[model samples]
Target: MRSILPFALALLALPAASAQQQPYTPPKHTAPPPPGIARSTPEEVAQQADGGTQIERDRPATYALAEHRRLTRALGTLLPQRKGVVDAYVLSIALDSDPVFGREAREAGKVLARRYDAVGRTITLGGSDGKAPSPLPMGSPANLEAALARIAEVMDEQEDVLVLYTTSHGAPFGVVYNDGNEGFGAISPRRLAALLRAHRIERRLLIISACYSGVFVPPLSGPQSAVFSAAASDRSSFGCAAENDWTFFGDALVNRALRKPQPLEAAVTAAIAEIATWETRGKLKPSLPQQSIGVEVQAWLKPLEARMPKVATAPVGKPSVDSLQAP
Candidate 1:
């Protein structure tokens, strides 16, 4: 991410004639999203009946209208769904503007798209470098909702699956969205569950790479879903430095495990073990990644797994974690 201190200092050094330009757009929230959204249940969310309007919404940045237009065109480009096929619609997002999250999202999208034969059905959102002008639209809650709305309209609910991968910073409350200083918001467990239900997306594979992301597993997981979290509810995952390419959980799971031809269950098992090895060697507190797979998911999951490339791709980028001292 852009260094906050230097960003502020640069503003102070700007020429007086050009000082009117703001460094970044300020967020519209008067306060952070309400606490306790993590504790809400599906029934409670359904009763509200506002489709997540209670939470702080992600608004368009006035300065990034071109990026907003790109989002519109990106959604427009999604190929029409194929009939009688188990088409997977993939939505991979980097909610935070941190370069690490961006890189992880982009790579994860490629891996998933190839695995599921979703080349024309994938949408990736995030900047490769947090400071540069990105060709893709920056990730945000509103953008995600829009993508889902479109996918719901096109895909056959009975034959298709939604694969969502989100990588970002997090809190016990929810996944964090920090697009530099230009955008901010959170997607609580309640909020995400509500979105999926509203879109009628029943078959899903939800992989969340963020601190304390286990909070999502309880509300969103079911007989038709497979949910994987980077850490337990109270723990923080590692390897999210702005200069790095992948977070610890992401590198282990998407970059390494899932790239091989294996069942989802086996891939998750291997990733958890790999993450544990790294944490043990580094002498850091274990993040304790979590997974929940519905028994019913296997009927369709097996077919998709069978389609995976026979040859695994070699991993790219520096490893997310390493032994601090020589083993």
Candidate 2:
């Protein structure tokens, strides 16, 4: 009887051990729908929040038309009946909804327009003080698309170059497109590449001034493009707070380097050095501004450089690293 009892106990333990070795399978349950709300599928939720739908359905028509008209006028100013050697189009996007980005973007646009001889051709898109009619429109996906389309209408894709300088907060995903009280969404690297391709604008210079902007280079870089980013893919940029006049990169690149008589490539190189010094002084992790210049872009940019204005640059000064910390 004792032997039989021991064998029976071992047999019972075998089932328990097998159960312990088995993979976990969570129990599934179908709960009743809420008393009044209807159940929604994942697809339905996504469609409701789709970027295009959010703008069209949520944005008021009157405001939309007013913004559209403003952009049309701005673009009209730049459409030279005869295309120049390089018809530069500057799009300065302030995606963070902060006045600092807005101000910096506007100033950068002016600088690029002056340097590239694109005074009337440059389009500035962002919010501004209520005192004046806002330039272009608030930074949104729709506005960005419209601005690109307008440029395409006037620009000779084969001969002219597009210089797009965007400044704002960014993530690993891409540049952030926010309108403060309006709404916000990310412009993923893939999506931005698609937008540029859709326009069929081949020769391009893209400067992304934002945190983690290096993520844009891999996806957007091509033989006909020169991509510059404010930080490496894993790093954050500085001087993005609401009170500052410019981000660390924007100030160095646009306010300082590009304002001089130097070529775009030289300006980019100088900006890199300036950024490194600022980061070191702040005792912050290096942003490591990145530049990916395609072989073809150098040839494309030569004519534009020939036409660029030679301006006297003020002596470059060190940014107050303490005030330029990332917020």
Candidate 3:
């Protein structure tokens, strides 16, 4: 499995303080600084004095219109929302190029879709195994925003639930997005909160698999939302090797626990226990995955849970923790 060393180093390099501050939306006339130059001054250092004039040069790639059209077509495939029914629209995305996340996204899409009766209303975004051409759109901040907008447009926001599963590397600031050197971006908790709020998507089940993902829980948690994170705000989850089919959290929750005909809460409990055992055996510090289910969300979640398949499926692939060599 991939070591957490590189991920930890990357987190140390990020300005985690940005997450606590208000985002700086560049003025309409201000253009993103040209590539190949970062910044001579610290971002946000002089925000109040300069009226937020500073800019971080490493802007995310603004992909061609063709990419937008591709996502549009994918959105079009979703079945129209059913009136008077509590439907679930599933969106599974892998924000990083690592094959493990991609594989997890693909399988997560299938599992969530089936479990939630969202077979024709599921969208999967990520590369595949790093071998075959990806049949889905690459996951990025822009694409994710576009997808959510599209789902909002087609679904009944009050009655439908948004099942969003994002797998990636993360820092205290946000979930990182990197796609084979062509894409780089991040989705912070505030940014995501704004997106959902803007779309009026009240009911949501968000499962984030990433290091330091617990940062999202506080901002996104609400009476109509359930947030489950792979790691605590200050911790890093393991099993991120590129060649593997699943990360530790993905395997524990999606591959094993959720595969059974249990309630979501029960599944989460089982996954947590399983992960703890694995971590202890490997002599590793606990990642301390977190979960929060809103009180109001249960009213709608029960109907969705009632539709789950009774038969259980066997887990596939090697256990993620098994890759950890003895300490």
Candidate 4:
């Protein structure tokens, strides 16, 4: 009987061991290899040295989720259009097919507009007609002005204005339109802010999704408004797909929205966290997003308060929405 008891315990240990050895899941990243950097994983190292690395692979951005959390705790929800003193906004999707930002830019406007009803909505021009090469089209020298005029009519009698923008790439000066010609395209943040100021439009916000977009914050930041840009000043972000769909920032933003609806500030924070967290499986970084400028953002600023998001305060200067940590 004693010998049988020992054997029975050994059998039980074997099942537990097998369960523990089921399988190991590894993390992944999709960053590009810098200059001449040549490094590979242990498994790949042997394959390259012995058999040479295989070429059957997709781009790095095609990676899967890295980590997931589980807890009994749970939570929830909610940009808009303004008119007149505060009218509806002009959601500008600059889809320049030649530069490859059509579908993606348009989608970005749609996403934010649908999610945040407190700001201007998006209005895309071109791309479906295979006009992908041009950046800003038809919006004109008076593009923003014209768009605002239409917004004024939309809001007709409302009292807050907002502008959400998306495009492929840009520099410090302004946004590129669908028009191949760079004829004074894209409304500068400084000018846009000044325009808002002119109206005495109590509340406003601008969401800029493009390369080198950190420029949005400094020019547009104020006590009564906020600006959120997708990338830093000198970095390239993902998403140059055929249809010109969303990039890493877009995907991340959508994912965050799915996890839990939040105020502009919260949603932006969570998305930044998602990309900044790194992994070996993929080489993508959470975009270094920017937020409100130097001034502290008050949660309750009265009527306009409801217009601009109750976002966290970003330090003044470049890249506004950065997370400020306490020492």
The clash numbers for all candidates, in the given order, read 0, 1, 0, 47
What does candidate 2's lDDT look like per residue over 43-81, in tens digits? 543333233322222456587678768867766776662
What is the Å distance of residue 25 in model 2 from its true position?
55
Candidate 4 global Cα RMSD: 18.1
lDDT of each: 0.81, 0.74, 0.81, 0.45
RMSD of each candidate relative to the true structure: 8.4, 20.7, 14.0, 18.1
lDDT of 3 by residue, 1-327 (tens): 989999998888677766647443211213333243224233322222122121223335664555667787888888998998899999999987777888899999989998899999998887655566566777877678778988998999889999999998887777876666455557788788889999999899999999999999999999999999999999999888876778999999999999988999999999999999988988888999998899899888999999999998887777787788624
Q: Estimate each model's TM-score.
A: 0.81, 0.77, 0.81, 0.52
Model 2 spans > 4 angstroms off: 1-62, 81-84, 129-135, 313-327
Candidate 4, position 4, lDDT:
90
Model 1: per-residue lDDT, tens digit, 1-327?
766998887887787638556353222224443444445575543333234333333445564588679898879878888876788899999887778888899999999999888898999987655444567887877788888898898888888899999999987777877665446566788889989998888899999999999988998889989999999999999888886778889999999998998878888999999999989888889999988888789866877776778988888887787424324
Model 3 residue runs over 4 Å out of place are: 1-66
Clashes of 2: 1
Q: Put down candidate 4 lDDT per residue, 211-282, tens digits, no spaces.
A: 667776776777656677777755544454333334555545542442244555666777666556521124
Clashes of 3: 0
Instruction: Report the error of model 3 at residue 161, Å.
Output: 0.4
Report the error of model 3 at residue 26, Å. 34
